[model samples]
Target: MSEKLAKFFKLNERKTDVRTEVMAGITTFMTVSYILVVNPSILSEAGMDRGAVFTATILASVIAILLMGLYANMPFVLAPGMGLNAFFTYSVVLKMGKSWQFALTAVFLEGLIFILLSFFKVREAIFSSIPLSLKKSVSVGIGMFIALVGLTSANLIVQGDGVILALGDIYSKEAIVFFFAFLVMGILSTRNVKGSLLIGIVASTVLALILGVTKLPETGTIFSLPPSLKPIAFKLETHNIFTWEMLMVVFTFLFVDIFDTVGTLTGVAAKADMLDEKGDLPGVSKALMADAIGTTCGALLGTSTVTTFVESASGVAEGGRTGLTSLTSGALFLISLFFFPLFSIVPPAATSAALVIVGVFMMSPILDVDLNDYSEAIPSFITIIMMPFGYSIAEGICFGMISYVILKLAGGKKKDVSPLMIVLAIVFLIKLLAPKIFG
Candidate 1:
């Protein structure tokens, strides 16, 4: 028993601190709890009900992240991801006029492709193909983009006609909740407090309850499970996978999720000191595989695509090592499934509190990029600035990649481009030009 435990936790040779492990678990829990609700909100917009989506979120987080810890031996947590939710709700369902069922089908297919790609040695090849300058840009851009999302979701920013983005009303419900959340997050982050995000969320939830903002519309005569929450006891629809529309949507889902997972892994690696000297990450392929499994499971369970969250870096920074942290985190998520009353009460304001603080933590990687070098500066600048402005993660990433390719090609350094980079560039360009070409 001791030998098996040692191998599972990698604790045989050296001493392990129970306190540090517990702290890491708390960090992972804090980071993922918000997404439990947020995933449903985004997917609900695409016609999914609340309870079923929550169930899927729990199942995916448990299965995928635990697998990551057990097999991959990485301290990253996987869950229903944020950016991909936007893509699924916005691009797939709304923009493409596809049904929610069709969208899930696409997400499932994308996961299969990602799994295949991971096995075929495409993961490292794709990463290597990306331009160095673009990679730097992606790093910085995603950081800034995540921060912008934090701010906007917190209602710190709002849309304005004259301005692309403007300050939100401080007195509004969302804005007020966001303001106090940000305040708490600032204090926790500045003090280098462990579980600072968790603190902010708890504080915000307390304040919201005191202000009489805790009540939400009940599901039925009394709150009960939504039908959609039922695990795949029945399939929704059978779409022709070979159809051009399905194929395009699947490809889009693949493109967005792969890059999103890559960017997240990169960010988390940086936070956890998991990066090699060459700035490349080990275990990324394993992480990608874990993410693919999560997405696949999420689809089968009737939820949106699942991916890695940048916020897991918080747990990593809190002294997490080995897969134990992810396993612990996943266990917490699965256990929470029975506590619907408690889970449903987590106000968006409180969740926003955690997200805003996490955004600030993620922004640390921006400092590593040398702003003085134009090669690095342009792509970084584009990514950092465009994320908030474009209001889409893929747009920001695509722009950064495009700029990096153009700059490198112009510099007569075409030979420096990797085949994967070239493939990404070509695919990205074609994606952008498709409307014009097909129209």
Candidate 2:
């Protein structure tokens, strides 16, 4: 069985064996398993049924990770993205006063457009056209955004009317537990402990239970049948799909997914020493297609945009070099279906710690940015700050793109900006200004 598995995954060529791949896969799943709890909680806030979203989240992840393994032959896992799901719930539905069905329609349309773009190779072209500085900024910006989310969700940070922001009560039991969990996770991660984040999450949950911050579930059973998807599945409202506002939503989803997947793939591939002579990832087009198809399937299953996870780096860091790692993770997700009761009880503070740790992991790329160049530094700064301050990934990207173009043109470095970027900046400007003009 080991020989056949190795042959199928080309493990020998990738310098990985079955045991290593299995361990890598387990590490990957451990780091990302927080999504099992977090995704359902966030989407349920948007009025979707919690059980249904839970089933949908696992199903979407299973299918997407499987496809990524079989087709792309890459060690990556796919799930509903963090920032994109928040945007789906908060920005699109709550802020815009749109129905969850309308938001699902926007996600569906975005996935369809992604499919078309991937088919024509336009997705790759668009990815390649973005300036390297902007790409690094996006990573750093998303890190800050995720960290802010963690702090806010854990009540470690709170709103202040006069001051805009302030620290929450560290003396509170929940806050204390969160801080301890964060400290443990940070130390473990710094020490290169495998599954350290997951361990910290579990430890936090245990502490919360002991401290009376969260209660144990009353249910006696630990396993149960998965919930049906019928409630939210295929519920998209297509009547206003072509409206300019909806189009903008779709563009935002597409833009975030493209860059996020590209960034993750690039980072993980480099970690695995899989990059080609030109520093380009081999078989990346297939990986992008897998991501596109996953988003479409996830929307149909009643979730947000699905994309490759940066947590896959955990697997790569464990010596994963082939798709077997992803396949192993997918298998674990399949088994996770019956354990919903166990996952659903995890407190928000527990997952919040994981988010904070992951956020710190993502900030390493900021050091690569050229901070001395104003043309580069200002846009990067805007991208990094606006994401957390504005509480919207799409808004940060929009402002970052617009600022990059304006600064470059002003600096007489017009040639540094691409035509696609200019068009994107104009689209973003229209999206930003249209509400005032027509309202």
Candidate 3:
């Protein structure tokens, strides 16, 4: 079994052993396990059953993560993405006044489109067309973006009354927990501790209980049967699938998901040193197919798009170098399906600190960007700034790509830009102008 396992995952080639991979997988699972709580809470606001969404979240993640491991043989984990879920709930259901079923139909169609794109190698070509600086910038940009998410989650940052953003009460218990947890992560990770991020998260949760930042679970509330998916599963409202709004919605879903998956896959692979000499992830086709399959399966099972999670970086930092890491995380998610409340009891501040630390891990690629080259620097800067500020990885990539092609073309460096890049820039151009044009 060990020989088959090592041979299947190329553990020896990757310089990772079974025990190291398993521990790294545990570390990865602990870091992203918060999504089991977070995704349901957000989607339930759209009138989906909280219990149902919870079940959907874990089940979808398990399916997707398994595909990533078995098919792609990459350590990337998949889940209903954060920003995309927000879009499903707030932007589509609340703001656009679409029914939740309508949103599901849009997601369903988008996933189908993605499958087609992946099968044809279109997605792979797009992935290869991105400039190296922009690819590195995606990592740095996601670092900042996820750090901002962490700060807000920990109440260390808040929406300002008159300004755009402001600091939270540093004296507050939540802030204190974040500081302590972050320090634990820093020191432990610096000391090369196994599962440093996981340990820090555990430490933060204990402190949260001690300081009353969050409460403990009610007694005897750990394990339970998963809620039925009847309320939300297979509930796509196809009546609007051919409408103008549907077209826009589906297009939006497809566009954002494509780039978001691209950005995430690129960033995490770069962080893991999994990229080849030409700055491309090996087996990217299989990776893209796994993501596409996850999205489609998630929509059918009642959830948002399931794409690669950036939190996978936490495991890579802990020395996870093969599909075994993703497989192990997937197995934990399956077990959690029966232990829902137990995982939910983990305080948001606990996971928030890990995200902030993961952000620091992702920031290393920034040094690779050539600041002296204005064309490269500006787009890279835009990509990095736009992710957190725009609150969308896809939006950041859109702006970065469009600006890169335009700047390169204008500077008589047209040769630097590829034909595919020009095509992508035009698509991004349409995206920027669509709101005004359609409105």
Root-mean-square deviation of every model: 3.6, 3.7, 1.5
For lDDT, the strongest prediction is 3
lDDT of candidate 3 over 1-439, digit per residue (tens): 9889999999999999898788778878887888888798999999999899988988888988888999888888899988799999999999999999999899899989999999999999999999989999999998888898889988889999999999888898888888988999999989988888888988888898899877756767787888999999999997788899999888878878889899998888888888887778889999999889899989999999998988888888788889999999999999998887677667877778888888998999989989999999999999999999998899899999999998999889988898999999998998789889999
Which window of 10 residues has the lowest lDDT sum in candidate 1?
219-228
After superposition, candidate 2 runs with Cα above 4 Å error: 1-35, 38-48, 81-103, 235-282, 308-325
- The pairs that clash in candidate 2 are none
User: Across residues 65-174, which tens digit of lDDT does each residue of candidate 2 receive?
Assistant: 88889988889999999889999999998999898999999988988888898889886765566677766776677667768878898888899768888888879888
- The per-residue C-alpha lDDT of model 3 at residue 245 equals 94
Output the better candidate (1/2) by lDDT.
2
Candidate 2, run of 10 with poorest lDDT: 270-279
Q: Name the Cα RMSD for model 3.
A: 1.5
**Model 1 CA deviation exceeding 4 Å by range:** 1-18, 41-49, 86-98, 131-136, 172-177, 215-236, 317-321, 414-416
Q: Report how far residue 211 has shifted in candidate 2, in Å.
A: 2.5
Cα lDDT tens digits, model 1, 1-439, are 6456557677533244445555676667765687877788888888877667887888877889877888887777888777778888898889988878888888788888888998876876676555544555555555566666667666677787798888877687766766787788787668877656666767877777777767533653333443345644224456467788888888777877777777667656665656666677766777778888888887888777788776676576566766777777887787677655565566766666565555556566667777786666787788767766776566777777777777767878777656666667778899889999899
The C-alpha TM-scores of every prediction are: 0.86, 0.82, 0.96
